[model samples]
Target: MTAESDPWAAHARRTVGGPRPLLTEALELLGRPRRRVALDLGCGAGNDTLALLERGWTVTALDGSAGALALVQERAGVHRTRLTPLEAGFHQVPRRRYTLVYASLSLPFTPPARWDRTWRAVRRAVGVRGWFAATLFGPRDGWAGEPDMSFITAQALRERLDGFEPVVLREWEGEIRLAAGGLHPSHTLTVIARRLSR
Candidate 1:
């Protein structure tokens, strides 16, 4: 199913566009790990997916938006066999394991009430010694209390990822202007975790 048929295509379009700093950092960290299979959750616009491909990663780009996939399909130099586009939400991904999983600026959209369950699914999807890079909104973020968004305290987030070793925990706080228009002060927490075991 393409992103055009998906109802959330517009929202995804507004959510992501260009390359993000966290995406660059993730690529740097993956160089030594030699990650081949990657899952780019909420890969809107394919910026991150294309980045992964350039890094020689075989990617499964998942987004609930069909427009997002269209954007990916239009990207140059990426082979069709190297990239698999799946228009699916976090909850509906096919059960499988990945060597690397990046969910940039996407976890906040998960329903708070089920955030833990969703996290568990993410944890399960990343294989042993796999790398997981994701962006999560913090309590100080303006969108914290917004509907369908999940925000957690630093301590709470630390506890949630107790089983994994956190390689990077950079707290980003500043005002960002969206391309669509509007500025909001954001408190973003970027986490890079390595799954050592179950």
Candidate 2:
């Protein structure tokens, strides 16, 4: 599909406002990392990537859409030197250690069959003491029944972070604004956890 018509592209355009609260809270908890490196998984439109760059972080912004990556680079401007844009899908994510791995409102898009593998890659990408912040959809979300997407209960999500120390774990169920510009019933889990062990 064309970039103008792609739903993801449209979503990216709408979400360029600022970084999410999960990321800000995670950064506050993390303080100054030994290494100022971060991986912006599914960095739609580079909103979070720009936030990290402004804080002097070397960011790797990964998105499946080339158009999205272009937008990231464009928005980065002078911060482009610190930004590494990678165009790849969740299943194609490489295992690379980083001080922080942030995936906002993206993991749920992974197909159920690829969820385990993708989650493993994401987990391994976090170095010891590193932080991970993400927003995951719950089974009650409007898209939960779709076979191409993955949804988890709050308890199950916590179980998956076996080696991580929970910093911020919040779950909410109510009407949420959609990327395409409307309201919908949604259940989401937002987490910022620190990896305690390898």
Can you list the residue pairs that collide in candidate 2? none
How many steric overlaps are in each model, in order? 5, 0
Write the residue-wise lDDT of candidate 2 on 20-94 in tens digits: 877888889989877999999899888889999999999999998887888899999999999999989886766
Q: Per-residue lDDT for 1-198 in model 1, tens only? A: 544566466655665556788878876776656558989988887888887777677889988777768768777254666998897778665578898889988888988777877888888888888889998888899887787888877777788886788889888889988655899889988899888887
TM-score of decoy 1: 0.88
Q: How far out, in Å, is residue 111 in model 2? A: 0.4
Compared with the true structure, the alpha-carbon lDDT of candidate 1 equals: 0.80
How far off is residue 43 in model 1, in Å? 0.2
TM-score of 2: 0.95
